[model samples]
Target: MAPKVTVLDYGAGNVRSAVRALEHVGAEVKLSRDPQDIREADGLLVPGVGAYAAVMDALKASGSLRHLGYRIAGGRATMGICVGHQVFFEAGVEHGVRTEGLGEWPGVVERLPAPVVPHMGWNTVQAPEGSRLFEGIEDERFYFVHSYGVLEWNFDVTQPAMRPPLVTWAEHGAPFIAAVENGSLSATQFHPEKSGDAGAALLKNWMGTF
Candidate 1:
């Protein structure tokens, strides 16, 4: 049976575009806000375009966020886009408001400070070796329109000096973590749907992980 991939619609996501993109990749995709739908999904894609606090509140109220986390932690493939990516972090400091997040990835989300608030336009992505989400996708450019990014941290407790480390992919005006992959969970600060051919291929690669 083809795996049913669920695109989460928590009132804060661009669910339609995400679903269409996933479908284009030849995957069985569904746009759902129901917990049952998410629970039975083979993979989960969280697409968003909004404030962190608002998105978090919607997920909490709907009880979809917690269930989604459980599914991912249980070894289900998951992907997050843009603000959707940011919400997977421990917390967010956007627009000067501090908000707690899903705590899936250990890091803090903060706005790209200074000269650039929202880093918009096409930017190149460096896909590190062994990245399944970026298979067949070379050093390609993708569409990005975000002001927030994740601050990578060291997972080992013994390595205190190496702890709270940062893993940056692309450097715009400054270095920022654009894409992150931790175990089965992966996320991107760029919009693959709006990224044309390269983005389409990238989404296809991610869906293939299921």
Candidate 2:
């Protein structure tokens, strides 16, 4: 059977596009609002499109905050998109207010240093060697429409005892973390669903992981 992927619809993302993308990649997609679906999902895709504080607030209101964290920590094959990827950090600063995130990894989301406020449109990414997310589409540009992003990868992934994440980067005014793959947790700063062929290839790569 195909992997049953659930797209968390906590009232923050363009869920329909993500669902359509996932389905196009040959995975069985489910739109979910219940925390129970998150717990039982073969794979989870948390999609978001908005400010960090607001999205975090919506996730909290939806009551899947704890469950989402639990699944990622327990290695439940979770993937986050756009602002969904932003919430993987420890916190995010939007309009001078810092909001706590799911903290799937140690980092912070802040405004990009680009001259343009929002880094909108297609851009190529610098994927690490052996990237499972970028896979065959490493060189292709993906769609991005965001003003905030994670600027660095803090932990030492080179340690033999640790499994380092595959960190991908892209630059507007400066380089920023565009994507990450660590164990069962994976994410993208760009909207792969909105991206064209490159996006579809990336989604297929994610489904193949499960």
Query: Which tens-of-lDDT digit does each residue in 120-202 have in candidate 1?
Result: 89988776777776777767888898877764554566755542322337666666777777766778888988888888898
lDDT of each: 0.78, 0.89
- Model 2 misplaced stretches (Cα beyond 4 Å): 157-160
Supply candidate 2's per-residue lDDT for 18.
88
113-140 per-residue lDDT for model 2 (tens digits): 9889799999999999999888778789
Using TM-score as the measure, the top candidate is 2
Residue 156 miss distance in model 1 (angstroms): 2.7
Clashing pairs in 2: none
Model 1 is weakest, by summed lDDT over 10 consecutive residues, at: 159-168
